[model samples]
Target: MRITVFGATGGIGRLVVQQLLDDGHQVTAVVRTPAKLPLTHSHLTVVTGQLTDHQAVEQAVSGADAVISALGPSLKRSTTGTQVTDRTRTIVQAMEAHKVTRFIGLATPSLADPRDRPHWEHKVLPVAAGLMFPNALAELQGMTEAVTGSGLDYTIARISNPTNKPATGRIRSGFLGHDKVASTMSRADIAAFLVAQLTDSRYRRAMPAISN
Candidate 1:
């Protein structure tokens, strides 16, 4: 399988790229700064461009088996809270133009999933995230809306409390308001789950929260 990855320089994103390569899939990493990502492999192709660069994005998305994004929130005060939303919209357009169907992206619990039952964590987490970082929350919510409405085979993995610990490969996936889900998940597990979605159809067009 050939995969195009966005946010390949990020914590979980880097792991996703490496895992994809290790799995023997061809990877096209669209990154702003190629130097930020030091991994080099025969199966990896690094494309230099921002998401806003339509031509470059199109080039990256064209003839790809799937597109995966690990984009996260930007907490900088200068940010207008639409960073992820705007960039994701560009990617969705590129995918549509190129007739690519599969898309896997990341989000937070602040973006509600219809399957989510009324739980204390669902209520409190969004509220606390909003209070602490309003802009960041808005970015995630916007991203969710864009992807869910893009009319593509999409899976939005809503993760929480991403830690830097080693990958346990034991991830608990559930709705935010459920007791089965925990508060923290390692970045490695998150990356593994996201990469696994490339071939997993169980979560197509579904938003499931994951934790460990």
Candidate 2:
């Protein structure tokens, strides 16, 4: 598969790109600062650009078979004024223009995947994330619209509190945040599942959550 990824400098993005290369897929990683990506592979192509740049994004999406985006704001870090929704919007537009659809995105667990979630777990958490981080919640909610409204085959892998754990390659996925600290998953597992989606057609449009 020819895969294009956004937010390739982040922890999860880097892991996913590496895993894709190891899986023998052609990888094109799109990043804001190409110098920061730091990867060398015969099959890897690193492009420097952010999502708000339409021409740059359009060019990036030109020949991709699938797109897996781990793009989002850092709750603890600061870098730019860009929102995650803008990136999703660019991916959606580029996919629409190029007739490429399969989009897999990473999102927060607070956004309920009501279908895959238990009733009470779905209710309380999203409400809390909304109450505390209203702005971030709003940004993610806007992102939900950006993906769902894109008219493409999309999957939102709503992840738990992501950690930098080894890729055990074994993890559980669902909407079960009611289990206390189990609402956290490793960053590598999220990338694993994101890449897994590309090989399995059943994941299209499903919002699956990951936890350790």
Candidate 2 at residue 71, lDDT?
81
- C-alpha local distance difference test of each model: 0.89, 0.79
| Best model number under lDDT | 1
Off by over 4 Å in 1: 177-179
Tens digit of lDDT per residue, candidate 2, span 1-212? 99999989999899899989989999999998887788999999998876788999999888899888888765633333447877778789999999988898877766766565455656776787766666666677778888887788988887757888776777676555433335667888878888888877765776766676
**Residue 161 deviation, candidate 1, in Å?**
0.5
Give a tens-digit lDDT track for model 1, residues 1-212. Answer: 99999999999889999999999999999999999999999999999998888899999999998999999878775667576789999999999999999999899877678888887766887898888888988888888888898888999998878999999979888775553877699999999999999888888998998888
Off by over 4 Å in 2: 76-82, 175-181
RMSD of each: 1.2, 2.7
**Candidate with maximal TM-score:** 1
